[model samples]
Target: MSVDLQTVKRVARLARIAVSEEDAERMTGELNAILGFVEQLNEVDVSGVEPMTSVTPMEMKKRQDIVTDGNKAADIVANAPATEENFFLVPKVVE
Candidate 1:
């Protein structure tokens, strides 16, 4: 697919970019080059190829989902400047 000057201008307008006429022309060429490279990528053979998350093969680790207290209440409250009844104290905003 080719990007024309009008298409480039429309794209610039949608992106809220301040594109001059000369800059739009330059952008048209750059966009066309990127599309051409993507077209070239489409020509590659990928028959029977598995999709990969990375270049190297790796097994995703699994863990059981269970809820438990982190057991650091005292440590967490230690950094608070004002705490009362095992909870952080904040200034009252309403009567």
Candidate 2:
């Protein structure tokens, strides 16, 4: 797809980027080149190719599903200026 100066300016404004006329012109050519490359890729035949996550085959490492706190309540409460019943004590703000 061909990108014109007005389209480049609009895209820059939407992205909240300040682009001068020269930079916008340059960007227009760069964007068009990227689109041309994508168009070329669309012409390739991939009828028998399988989708893959990685180039080489390898199993993903995974840990057992478990949920537990680190058991550092006492250590954490020790750092608080005021704590009671294993919880931080803060001043009441709502009432």
Candidate 3:
């Protein structure tokens, strides 16, 4: 789609930007050029191209999902002033 001075000014107003008539007029051409490039890109055929994460291929780093320092429920609640069933008790603030 093409951009006009009114569209530029409206966008600036919605973004809370104070744009003058000169700036809006300038931005109208700039926005239209950018949209023209995007429209051109839509004409390219990419149906057979696969999605890629990077230009250079490399395996993603991973870590083992083994549990460590677990089964310490009682030890965790030992320092709390109030705890029940390994859960901290707090005063009810809502009614």
**Model 3 weakest lDDT span, ten residues long:** 61-70
What tens digits encode model 1's per-residue C-alpha lDDT throughout 1-95?
88899999999999999999999999999999999888887778999988777887778887778865687888899899999866899999899
Backbone N/Cα/C clashes per model: 0, 0, 0
The TM-score of candidate 2 is 0.44
Best by lDDT: 2
Local distance difference test scores for all models: 0.89, 0.91, 0.90
TM-score of each: 0.45, 0.44, 0.45
What is the per-residue lDDT of model 3 for residues 4-91, given as tens digits with 9 covering 90 to 100?
8888999999999999999998889989988988898778899999988788888888888877667999999999999999999999
Regions of model 3 farther than 4 Å from truth: 44-95
Candidate 2 lDDT by residue in tens digits, 10-72: 999999999999999999999999988788866789999987889888889888788656788
